[model samples]
Target: MELKKSTQKRHQLLNAALDVFCLYGFTGASLDDIAKRSDMHKSNIFYYFSNKEALYIEVLTSVLQKWLESMQMLNVDEDPEEMLTKYIESKLEFSRLNPKASKLFALEIIQGAPYIQTILKGSIKKHFRGKVKVIAQWQTQGKIAADISPELFIMNLWSITQSYADFETQFEVLIGKTLRNRSFYQTAMKNNLQLLLHGALVK
Candidate 1:
C-alpha cells in the first residue's frame, strides 16, 4: 500500500510538473510553481525528483517512449499509402491527446535542447533514420513513388504537422478557427496531407 501510494504521488507530481513546465518552460519554471500546481508539498516533490532537471527528464522520457510506441505501430507491411496515412493520423492524434507534452517537446527543440541534445542526437536520430530507410526501401521496391527523397519527404511531413502544435496561434489566425474544440480541422489536415502526397507519389 505504501509503495502504491508513493508511485501514485510521483505520477501526480510528474503530470502537474509537465503542465507547469510547458507553460513557463525550463528556465522559467521553479519547484514552488510545480508544487503549487501539483497540490503537493515541495518536500514531497523532491522526494520523487531530486531537482527540476530530473523531473523534466522523466516527463520527456515518458512522452518520448509513448511517441515511440506510436511510431513502432507504423506497420511496414501495410500498403504504403495506408501506412503513410496512418502515420499522419497518429501524429495528429498524439498532438491532440498530449498537447502539453507536445508543447514541451517543441519548446525544448526550439531552445536547442540544452539538456536533451544527446537524446536527439542518439536514439531519436537513429530511429528517425531507420524510418527513412524503410521509406527508401518502400520506394525502391515501388511501394511508394521513386522520385522523392525519403528524408526530405519526412522532413516536410514533420514540419507541416509539428508546425500546427508549435505555432497553434499562427494556425488559428491563418485558418480563423481553433482546432482544439473542433473536429473539422482533422479532415482539413487529412486533405492537406493528401494534396502534398499527391505531388510526391508516382501515380
Candidate 2:
C-alpha cells in the first residue's frame, strides 16, 4: 500500500512536470513550478529525482518511450499492409491522446536535444534501425514498393503522424475540429493510411 502511494505520487510529479515542461522548455521550466503544479513542496521533487536536470531527462525519456511504443507493432512477420495500417492508426491515436507530450518532445528536438542526445544515439537509434530493417525486409519480399527508401519512409511516417500533435492549433483552426472528434479522427486515420500505404504498398 505504501509503495503504491509512493509510485502514484511519483507519477503525479512526472505528469505535472510534463505540463510545465511543455509550457516552458527544459531551461525555462523550474522545480518550483513543477511542485506547484503537482501540489507538492519544492523539496519533494528531490525525493524522486536527484536534480532538475535529472527530472527533466526522466520526463523526456517517458515521453519518448510512449511514442516508441506506438510503433513497436511494426515487424517483418506481419502482412506489410496490415502492420502499416495498425502502425498508422496507433500513431494517430497517440497524437490525439498525448498531444502535449508529442509537442514537448518536438520542442526538445528543435532545441538540439541536449539532454537526451546520448539516448537518441544509442537505444533510440537501435530501435529505429530495427524498424527500418523490417521495412526493408518487406520491400525485399515484394511486400512494398521496391523503390521506396526504408529510412525515408520511416522518417516521413514520423513527420506526418507527429504533425497532428505538434501542430494541433493549426489543425484545429484549419479543420474546425480537433483530432478528438471521432469523425475527424476516422477521416485522419483513413487518409493517412491511404496516403502512406497507397504509395508504399505493392499494388
Compared with the true structure, the alpha-carbon lDDT of candidate 1 equals: 0.79
Query: What local lDDT score does residue 105 receive in model 1, on the 0 to 100 scale?
Result: 90
Q: After superposition, how far is residue 105 of candidate 2 from its true place, in Å?
A: 0.4
Error of 2 at 181 (Å): 1.6
Model 2 superposed RMSD (Cα): 1.0
Tens-place lDDT per residue, model 1, 88-183, is: 777776776677888899899889898788888898888788888888878887877788888888878776766667777776788765548557
After superposition on all C-alphas, the RMSD of every candidate to the true structure, in Å, is 1.8, 1.0
Point to the candidate with the largest TM-score: 2
Instruction: Evaluate residue 166 in candidate 2 and report its C-alpha lDDT on the 0 to 100 scale.
Output: 96
Report model 2's TM-score to 2 decimal places: 0.97
